[model samples]
Target: MERERMVRKTEIVQVLRMKEGTGDTSFAKTAYMARQILLMTKSIREKVMKELYYCMEQPKILCIADLGCSSSVENNLMSVVYGLIDTIDKARRELGHGPQEYQIYLNDLPGNDFNTVFSSVTRFKDNLKEKMGDDFGDCFVNGVPGSFYGRLFPTNSLHFVHSSSSLYWLSQVPEGIEDNKRNIYMAKTSPPKVLKAYYDQFKKDIWMFLHCRSKEVVDGGKMVLTLLGRQNSDPCYSNRTGYMWELLATVLDNMVVEGYIEEEKLNTFNLPIYTSSPSELEFLVHSEGSFALDQVHASEISWDANDHKNRSSCDQYDFAICLRAVVESLIVSHFGEEIIDEIFKRYREIICASMAEEKNSVDYITISLTRKSRG
Candidate 1:
């Protein structure tokens, strides 16, 4: 018989988005950690701006894109993009260039809530006009819905590209790893083949990403990527990156034991995430040969990288809510919606139990690159 079908019938693009709305299930509420990653990479953003200053002279239109720009509760994530626009505008003006028009693209998967982002455009423009007064150049923002694994824009159309808390997501689940039953991601117990499958998928996706972006971004354009990563030189099975999934697996296993979900279904499920190390990223950049790596910075961020004192007091609940906002769509599609609340309830208990034993967090790597001039 042909190899067993491991890939599910569900489409990833339609199911991988954060919960839609401004509530706790919404990505806006749960993606505070992503915003924190953006803040942490402020220096990288500045460096890209400086590079852009030298790349162009008296340009009239600046094309910038925020890849994986999901909708937020307060539209704060776009504020990060807005900050990018402001910095680029300021840098151009400081170089004595006249006002330049801006074409901004906010990209995410088709299932994303673009309506929310579009709803804020008027307010965003109004704020820009107010902040810069007469100096503000007209800005046109549009939503581009597609996966970044392939070309999403025309060749040589973009100047600056930014993605934060994205890219760690593989294009799709790796092939052939479904045999590693009982785990939704790479874990300490994952066999060597399973780990290799995950790494190979990441390598291909990252390379394809760089290759596609190389064609889309103009020569000398800059791209900044902040990704979930591991600081350890080689952490294929490190707890820092896989512990959350391990706990999630525990919950799933228990659910299977209690007949809450089918064992085969749980065994077939696998998350499409793979945290990278600085060395791995560097090697990919070199192998791709289209962009020059400008800088790589790594830092550790707690799972609860949000304002707990202000938003909510329960750490376990906060963590569960954040994870649920992103993974619930997948879980609900694969396991059915009825089990979501109970699954996360069990998840929270596991998180609390893990915390009681020791604190947990993961490393983030910020990589800056400049597109080399086309030969």
Candidate 2:
């Protein structure tokens, strides 16, 4: 049984990834919400630059990593790197410092579409040079493929670390959740034990993540993480956006009833995602004892946040497509690609119906931490 569970985990690691390419269905298009959150958060910018300025006091190549830096043909990875470099360069000029060299590591799971990210590097570099002219610094971008729950970098290697729309994903589905039954996540109907199991899994994964990063990041370095979260302390609270997993569970149940999918398969399936509360996040950071919690901010974004006012006509379809880009890989890993269209079709219908009744918005939590000096 243990070996079987390990194999299942291996399969998940091998299969779980965002839908690739630059098409409408790709994560690149859907990821605008994440980018928007990162750009709009004034505190995030301030914290990043403050720590970067501290790192600039040293006269060496600065190391910056974007954990969970999923790729896209649209070069979303490059866009983020560009923003960071621009900010750092501006700070350097104000301090009367010379141009600095940078080592940018774009990290994601092995299943990520790294080819797309690497292919855009030359163009990205050229554009940077054109914009910065004589002040262009030597920037080298490399892709690191692995899980952040474990070590992915050498000790004291990273100066700044940023992760957006990630970290809510536990290393794997919480074990002993077989009794969770019809729900894919911790719903209001879930048993107390199942909730505890999920929270425990989150605590374990997050502690390991912090431990690994504490070793990789230099003392006094900084990290900012933005992830889907809930404002309420209870994990089982029924927020409208938290209903996304429940809606998927309902669709699977319907398919099971209609003989499109097996009942047992639906019973066994569970999403590895968790929406943590700010209190919960703070507790883990303190308990980990490696980093000092700097700031915690929570905000909400609507399901169709990326849609323009003129594009309201197809908001429902666009919302469904965006969700599909995020979860299609996991669904395909379990249920096969055969029913992908039908499942998302029903998902879209349900979303449209639900949206009419109430606005669906997800809570996002941004946490900034500074690495403490090693004892």
Candidate 3:
């Protein structure tokens, strides 16, 4: 199923591919909204850079990987990346010699649009060349779309890794727990079972990611992970948190009541589940037997306001757009891609009703770790 959806995601990304300077406004220019992505993990990245750049024995070449780098445009993430690179450049200059080469690997799920990423990289590359000609070195950039938790690169090869606003997404919704719409995760009146399911999946995936890095990243290499999250995962199932689950549950329940779908159909549903806390992340680090905890500071980052356009209310269509872009593969594989459009429409109806009153404010956390030792 995973492999099948991977192929489908690749197709969607290709279809939505944007040209250089043609994506969201912030992708090409740094706007207030675009600047928001840097909030979650800035402190950790800065501290890690000190250790990375200050070392006299640093490698002459750096290989970088941006996991979940779906958009061609750098958007808000560009700031963090460019900032990191510029800092390293400065440190090298102080030493009177720069690295011989540098490369960045942009990765996303198979369904992600590489063309968009390509254009973004091209524009950013030109910017770098204009500013620092000889010192910049060679940049070999390519797209790798696959689950980072499993495998994506060769052993002990990567120098650095960065991911933002993506990790909290679970690989799959837990099986069998969705029998009751009221107890489902991502729905209104969602039971604790649903939330717990998501938490479990996150723990598994984070562990997988850490272990994968242990095999692929060289000793002492660095990683920066910034993701959407909450201070705690356990929240009462009520509108106080979000109408997402409530509205979704209502929509699905109505559909079942009208004989539009099966009773357990909601079982296939998975919530956005983006909330994560520092403690959850720390446990993964210690038990995963992979990356070392260099630091775990909370970054308060931002994103373009459009990121929440549909989530702003119960607009089923808008919710679908956000869901499709973020988790389209899951939807297509589970419910049959044929009904994806209808699903979005139904989703928007419920979401718009929920978000009609309040403005959208999305919050997330960014964590950075060091590849202290690799297996």
Best by lDDT: 2
Q: Per-residue lDDT for 1-375 in model 2, tens only?
A: 899778766776787788887777888766656655666564574556566575646557889898888765344544567777787777787777888898988888999988877888888888888887767568888889998989999999998888888899888888899999878889888899999999999999999999999999988888888889999887876565578888888999999999999988888888988899999999999999999998899988776653433232344567778789888999988889999999999999998888778778778899989899986
In model 2, the clashing pairs are none
Ranking by TM-score: 2, 1, 3
* Pairs that collide, model 1: none
Best by TM-score: 2
Q: What is the lDDT of residue 240 in candidate 2?
A: 51
**Model 3 over residues 1-375: C-alpha lDDT tens digits?**
778646643443443221123333212332232234554355567667757767536676677787766563466335666767777777777877755477677776665555656766778778777876756676667788776757899998887788876676556544345543543454445566765666676787788878887888888888888776555544443223243445545666676777765666655555535466777788778898677776666543222245433222222233334433444454454456676666657876656654565543444566767777523
Model 1: how far is 153 from its true place, Å?
A: 0.7
Tell me which of candidates 1 and 3 scores higher on lDDT.
Answer: 1
TM-score of each: 0.93, 0.94, 0.75
Task: Return the candidate ranking by lDDT, descending.
Answer: 2, 1, 3
Candidate 1 lDDT over residue span 196-278, tens digit each: 89899999999999999999998889898998888876545564867787889999999999999999999999998998889
What are the candidates' C-alpha RMSDs?
A: 2.6, 2.2, 5.8
Candidate 2 or 3, higher lDDT?
2
lDDT of 2: 0.82
